[model samples]
Target: MATSRDQTLSIVYSSTATRPLNDADLSALLAISRRNNARAEVTGMLLYRGGRFLQV
Candidate 1:
């Protein structure tokens, strides 16, 4: 019998928001990101702090 291995890849990145975003802006961003991610089979987390963003 033979065994097979699985392969996977990952990347991490961060960026700063060019402008301040209000509640509405944040909601819109989440909605758009969720749709796009679902289609791309991509899964990750997002963190917001002091106008900065970190995604992995």
Candidate 2:
């Protein structure tokens, strides 16, 4: 049997950045995202290329 807490939700989305992100900016953004997601017990992957972002 599976309880509500044992179920997990998954989401996938993509977006274009309004402004380009440099290496430093991208690194900082990823660091913050990792920290926050860890605190919320969430796991996923993020991809950035050509000023676009894809998160799953």
Candidate 3:
């Protein structure tokens, strides 16, 4: 994978109001990450392909 200056790193949960990730989505996905702290983590390579998904 590659990194970019404008690209961002993220860590989201199903109940994350800020991350906007769903529990169903997490269940069928592949992920690798490191711990930032309790109830907070960091994620990488979250590819957002074309879709009707609204992330805000």
Find the candidate with the highest lDDT and give its number: 2
Candidate 3, 1-56: lDDT as tens digits: 65674567554423223354566655444332233332353333434333223222
The prediction achieving the highest TM-score against the true structure is: 2
Tell me which of candidates 2 and 3 scores higher on lDDT.
2
What C-alpha lDDT do the candidate models reach, one value each?
Answer: 0.86, 0.95, 0.40
In model 2, the clashing pairs are none
RMSD of each: 3.7, 1.1, 11.7
- Candidate 2's error at 43, in angstroms? 0.4
Candidate 3: residue 53 lDDT (0-100): 32
Q: Could you tell me the lDDT of residue 25 within candidate 3?
A: 59
Poorest stretch of ten by lDDT in candidate 2:
2-11
Taking all chains together, each candidate's TM-score versus the true structure is 0.82, 0.89, 0.19
Q: Which of the two candidates, 1 or 3, achieves a greater lDDT against the reference? A: 1
lDDT of 3 at 36: 36
